[model samples]
Target: MKKKLGMFAGLVLFVVLMAACAADSSQEESDSGDSNSSGSEDSSAENQDTTEISFIHWRGEDEEVFDDIIGQFEEENPGISVQMNTYPSEQYQSNAQQMLRDGSTGDVFTSFPGTQFETINNAGFFTDLSDEEFVNNFAETSLEVGQSEGSQLAVPYQMVFNMPVYNKGMFEELGIEVPTSWSEYQAMAETLKENDITPIAFPGADIGPNQMMNSMMMNNAKNEDIFAQLESGEETLTNDWWINTLEDFQHFNENGYLQEDALGTNQDSAMQMVADEEAAMLATGSYHMASLKELNSDLELGFLPPITVSEEEVEYEGIHTATFMLAVNKNSEKKEEAKAFIEFLSQPDIASQYANETGQHLTVNDVDYESESLQNTSHWIDEKDTRFQPRYLIKEAAVEDAVLGSIENVLGGTSPEEAADEAQQVVEENID
Candidate 1:
């Protein structure tokens, strides 16, 4: 009886031990599963904390600089990420409004001054930035370009001289001085032709002629706001100023001062001509200086304003345009993040870095420039009397087309008077 009782006790003890071991194993498995679930939850929370915003613009050439800027921004704001979207200038101009309307793109976007700004602002796509603290960092003159109907809708990031870029080394070698009058400019062109160099590589195929017209009319127009006056009932395209500007285009064509097949030449080809020393000047803007230098690392370039008046009558020497206006999408969910990015850009150190790296003249004040071209041309912004680009003042597309088309017509052998008359008729038809 005693042996049987001991055996039962041993069996019970063994069973209890087995149960204990099984419970230990189960607990270990549960802990492992819990660890994995906790890790996954943490990762998901991290992702949810980050806010990604898209910045859309047409300056594809600025991708590298902006990438660097965005990296800095991300590091500073761990919760925010910026994705840059770039389109070609023409494509952006045509499709940006749609992209903004879709609400899936362009938390922040850039637009060209005047027409693009007007169209986009009219659609109420821009967030009102009037009260942003960063807006005060920019000069009032620069801010005016982005204002509409008492609201500051955007901010202009670039300040560029809308004049021709000339080879300073060539001018120095030929013992030529910068022309101060229309007659002197013609003589300078003649000298360039005499030296077997194309005087001006005019890119009539694209926006080149339109940009050049700003400087071409700087001194010829009766006032700086001639296009605005024409837009109102105060002026007409058939005025002497318009006729004289068309005649200037004709003179360039008739005197062989422009490149061969100038009207067919595109902006890139024109830039190449100047960079390769085949032409002495390109009828483009200061914005192309970096590109020209990239083509020829040793090219010394300068701005050449087409002085269309006598020295005494020259009220303005060149044209300055505040363009590439940046604005936030009114409907964006990431409005605060987008504005923070712009405010980061408005900081003087960041703006200077962008200006020096891209060779662009920024509108941000107190920015120290290190670009060679920018340093050389800084006087144009500081000392020279420059008017805002008149080409941008025309709000009507048909009128702008007609006015620019008049230059093309003159280049194609139409008389200046006839071109002026045709442009005037188009203007009358388009306006009230």
Candidate 2:
């Protein structure tokens, strides 16, 4: 009986040992399966190919912001990546033209509206965004730039209008009010001169000022559709609107309304005049407000369009053009990725992000920036009922010969009519 009991105990011990061995084997298999699963996941991740697209623009100072935007986009879409390229603004136009000619440009690039931009857009180098859903995101009238024959060529990131900037402090202290007519503006200039103040520091020495000045004068024209006529060679600078404009330039030069050695004064000196309170107003680029504020934080600057051709003008109508825009390469192999980047740029937050950094305004409707200066400029633009046309309505080369040279000729003692005739001949020769 004792032997049988010992044998039974031995059998029970053997059964418990077998059960422990089976549990250990099952645990080892589970661990091996998990290791294989993890390896497979890592291998899959390594094998995935991300689509890469290139975005080239001319804003060197804004490169950091673009990088941040691109980073965020890549994180959201791990399957896509972007490469950013910055080019100098001065050389961008020619470089872009060369790139188009070579078919070696990046997937996306920046473009403006003008004879050159039109020539490029008409050449089918840029994809049409007219029917894109993102097209509705642009501000009113801002989307018209870079458009040809109802097809939108690029997305206007901002609406740039080059007009005069007045010193709000000077206006308040001297009891000067904003002008609503050509005569009123003239009177204000005369008053400032009488008070021993340089009325306006005109940057006549710079090449761009003339084109902008032409746009300002054209804003008050009796015929605003003059661009179409000018382009078609059906109109000349000797027309009534242009005649009045040339006469106005002569009047400014003769009456000491413009600074002394005005042709010698560059943009920096012109802006400096306003900053030092030696001048009450300045005619410069659209983005000067940020720099002026940086120079004098206490300075209250306000933007003003040209007073109308006459006293009948009620609204401050001017040309609105895209100074910088995003154009997708139509020949891009990664067209889908390029389009995705542009669509991303269409968001209000993205459009206004640069404004926050530099106080430059964006063209997206209802988009706002945190910059106080930008807000103030926007307020004035809205209150004055500003209207817009393509900022690049005329050719830059033609403007240099006809308009800038016309102003210089008038300053050099040529009669306004003769200057106008000379300008008309130049326009007839160079008009696009």
Using lDDT as the measure, the top candidate is 1
In model 2, where do residues sit more than 4 Å from their true spots? 1-48, 313-315, 380-383, 389-391
Give residue 276's error in model 2 in angstroms. Answer: 1.8
Compose the digit string of candidate 2's lDDT tens values, residues 1-432. 999999999999999999999988866643322222234668545534666666777888778888888998888777677877888876776677667553335687888667557767767788887777777887656676667787888877866656677788888899988877788888888889988999878877774345446445755464656766776788777877677776777777788988888887888888889888899877764578878887778888777666645666544454445557777788766777777887787787877776677668777766766777777777634554455543356555565456667768887779878988887787777654
Candidate 1 — which residues are off by over 4 angstroms? Answer: 1-45
Location of the lowest summed lDDT over 10 successive residues in candidate 1 = 29-38
Candidate 2 has an lDDT of 0.71
Candidate 2 all-Cα RMSD:
17.4
Question: In each prediction, how many residue pairs overlap at the backbone (N, C-alpha, C within less than 3 A)?
Answer: 0, 1
At residue 305, candidate 2 shows an lDDT of 60
In the order shown, the candidates' Cα RMSDs to the true structure are 13.7, 17.4
Pairs that collide, model 1? none
